[model samples]
Target: MLRQLRGWSYMYEKIFDGIREQAHVRDELRMGLVCDACDLGPCTFDGSTSRVPCGITPDEMAMKNLAEKIAEGLGEYKTHKRHITMVYDMESLLEAATRMVDVSRSYSDEIDKLLSPYRTVRTVPFGLGGLRPEAVNICAVSSPRGIHDLIEFTRTPEAAENIECAGAHGVNIVSLGYPGAELAYQRGIPCIGNYLVLDNALATGCIDAIHTFGSERASLEEALKHFASRKGPQCELPEPKMHTTGATLDVTAINRAYERGNIEGVVVLFGAASPTCSWHMEGLVTDLVEHGYLVLVTGAHMYEGSTDAMNAPGVVHIGFCEIGKMHGKGFAPTPFVLVPGWKNAKILTSTLALVHHGYPVITGVRIPLTPSIEEKLAEKGCITELNGERVVERISELQSHREG
Candidate 1:
């Protein structure tokens, strides 16, 4: 059986002020402020004495081997695309965290204390728009004005030059865009650059950090863990439900199940690809988030296959694009939370980085392509949403979403 684990989970206190805050009227923008340290999962201390024998062991040799394999595969299949690709996007997750930290930086004493631990947060602005028609704007902004500032601000040549510096220095650069994986394969850089919805994105080592920005949060399992970590024992959050599928969960069904006494918490079992579903289960995420359901979004190709290279020379970089888009529109998640997957090691590292850096993430794997491969992915806890004819035209429909 494949092993599984939760990365980071956060709990939020539903805090709303005044009659306007509680009103269900559509005009109210201040949804509510739910704050609490969600519980994060158990981390493998780089090299621990009591190491578990996962697919990618916690040893540097295993990690290096995996990285070498990925690098070698890219070299062996040097099929290049002519398009200028945008790699990763910071999205709403990063932005919200920055906002949280910024708020914490200014107000709360507890947050001020935590700020020292999160000094690695990126302050500079960056993007990949021009040249690539399909380029995605992958950036992070803390305040409401951050995104606005980024879009309106003029590019200083000095900052533009920093791309070279960032790349050269191996600063875990994230690329946000659709063609990110192809771009990474062509560039030979570990595609830890952008966030995509497919499983291959993870297994291929395309994104280093899978940014879960915007609103709809992780399952109760992850959120509770998140709460425990930052808040200590004073907070009692929900327990994590290890589902058969390797997807992040939502609380809707679990809440219902609780009412029916189906079980204590929710347990989700899922696979990634759907013959009926289209293009990497994009809006399906909305369902997962809205329904309060836990899902293993995909399979090994994305999550387990991703950080399998944890012991590589340097940390890998992953990118997320849409999370930022959703949050920038002024919609706050009803219950904000995040969690990382346990299928791979780098996920833990990335999750820790985001949490430490103030970014919240929902744990999940990317969708794989081949059926047999997807079957293997199922073993790793991925959830399958659509199948048959519906699955065939998924990507084409996905393109429509991009266009529409």
Candidate 2:
């Protein structure tokens, strides 16, 4: 994918590398204990030096910082959910809710039994009572509204796979949003990763049609100009060498997989922002699959092109938001692990949400949690700060528990 884009002088790899390098530099600067309250010298939080010049203890400062980060992460997701809700009419909104309920009901008895614990019916309008209002709102509002003429892209592997399959069946596929271009590449389908890529993809004459959603409309006119200007010979892009032939799993397939005992466990790979981390996760996922685990991935992990991982008998590519909804209803009957490559706020919040829902989540990233939050998670048997080896160890135990 990088090589093909490079032909058009699109420096996506260079830009991403620059961003990652800057992020590392920022992390280095944050290592010092700098007091944000006042213009004071950088203070070291040794046991002897308990308090900073601002009259706050090191523990207090840490807790405050953690709280702010959590708030920021939660706010981002909430705002995204609100934006989806604001765009659709009430009739369309209710139709989405009804569809979800109908889908849930169509499951087999075994699948239904597995979903009963987390199945939400209430707060869905004309359903049984006792569903989480927030969950229902999120699921309903975020549901796809109308039939898309162009390929409406998002941050999900399933979306890319669907687009590719549709295109193969004689449908016009064009990207409208950010990310998942790599996943599309696996199937030999061209897709845009972001607005910049959208411009380039259109200019290359690879995209058949374009559709903009949300704030993407702001750059529509400029993108169209680029699309219109490039009418010369089209470039023949190289196909990815290691393509996986696995089908993307939907909600019904997910339930059926669980009921059939085809999925032993699930491992979510986060923080695909950096090339190095993404490479590491690709290897890790392959290892997990070899050990008979059903590897699940979202975000940039979808584009890693780990053929071995995908070909592993039980691999499933899904969206992060879809997994969050599935968590509410006990999707993984066995234990699962959440692997994070970086200290990302969104990943932290998603991990917390899963832990809050009583899933046996083993976290790979070390998130700074308040004592209360840590204790609650501990009570639920959620472990954090596990390295790759320890994570696999925990998964082995969980698999054993399932078999026993």
Candidate 3:
């Protein structure tokens, strides 16, 4: 109930009731990203303009957007972790994609080694119920780098004095994506909500500010003073509910079940936390599991569900989006992926890099034009379907082939 953005509390009921239904500025993303970087034309390349004053065709613009997103995620690693890699560009899209596939594996291995001891899961509180009306609420809308210090220091008493200064009152990791999951695993730092729940989270009239790293920034001091004095009925938070990560699920049991004809092929699920996408993804899991395939869930999609899904008979909740990326680059025997939406820049670019590697994907996003690299993948190359119905058919057909 805490996750619901609907009318849970009569006091702050309308704060986020009608936001999602609002009309979007653009009709649809033609291929890559909608260009709003300049004043010339905020175009979707809907065949309205022949030549964009931005000096790039729709194809070129898509390629550029893809490269930028990959660089953005990797660049963060460089800044905080001191990780370095050879940087390449526009014409070198294919080479860059190959490098991303290779380097990301190394990064996965490194992070695993550094934090291996904290892998096994346990039960943790899920909703806004744990929130105290008196204490300040600061959501950590953070990245791996941003949340690194708090998790690192809080391990011991002496080191914790540093982070215990401002964040000592009340703090919860809001939607830090993959890093948030990692933080939850390392120490049971409660992650209240993902990207979808941001609006209602702040609207609770008690959330003081956000501790930003990526897109969401913390509130300023002057603004916070008014927050305490602001007039409104504070919504009463529910009693905390228990959610488990491990949830008594095992991967080897899945592999053995596959051998025993109890399960068919394995499918890995990930991507952005769109409510529509998540609902469909959950449905896909239900359909796939019923079809006798073990569905491995991850990213925001995994967290958005009840423990019943996480602990489902044929469903295994993998670590986070890193597993999703690893699955993209033909991890051992490659598995099929369903990326329903790419609203986030990182996911969009990550999808580009995966497709550039010539891996076949079943996504609802329409690239409009295939890249030169995907062109090399040929008849069976990167498939970007726009219709959701056809996406299901494509996966069903592919699953049947795997069965055969």
| lDDT (tens digit, per residue) of candidate 2 on 1-404 | 88786764657767777788877445423543433321133344644466654456666666656776676568558544554335444333323333233333343233323323332211111111111111101001111221121223322465435434432222322331212322232222222232223334434443433443333222333333333454322434333223232233444555565667565555655333221122245556667766666666544334333332332335454322223324444453533745443323334444445555445676554345567766655565566644555567776765575567
Show how many residue pairs clash in every candidate, following the order shown.
79, 1, 1
Best by TM-score: 3
What local lDDT does model 3 show for residue 349?
A: 50
For candidate 3, write residues 1-404 as lDDT tens digits.
Answer: 66564545653655444444433433436366467432233556665656664456777778867786697678767543432334333335433444455566676666555655655666555446534455445566666545655444334455234224434433343333566555544445555545555566666765665666542222334224534564423556767655556433344554565556666556666554443342355466667766665566555434333332422336554445653335433233245666666545445556556656544566654443448634543244445555554655677676566457
* Regions more than 4 Å wrong, model 3: 1-96, 124-135, 151-173, 213-233, 236-242, 246-253, 275-279, 303-313, 323-333, 352-360, 370-378, 385-392, 402-404
lDDT of 1 by residue, 1-404 (tens): 12222222111223334444646442211221111111121223332233422222335434554565576467444532321122122233222224333332243233223322322212111122111111111222122223222322213454344423333212222223322321222221122222222233333222222323332122212322322333222222223111111111223443454456443222111212222223344344333323333222212112211211211111112222112211222211121212222323323333323333322232343332367755543333223433323322332333243346
On lDDT, the stronger of 1 and 3 is: 3
The CA lDDT of each predicted structure is 0.27, 0.40, 0.52
List the candidates ranked by lDDT, beginning with the highest: 3, 2, 1
lDDT of 1 at 175: 28
**Candidate 2 similarity to native, TM-score:** 0.44
Descending-TM-score candidate ranking: 3, 2, 1
Instruction: Return whichever of 1 and 2 wins on TM-score.
Output: 2
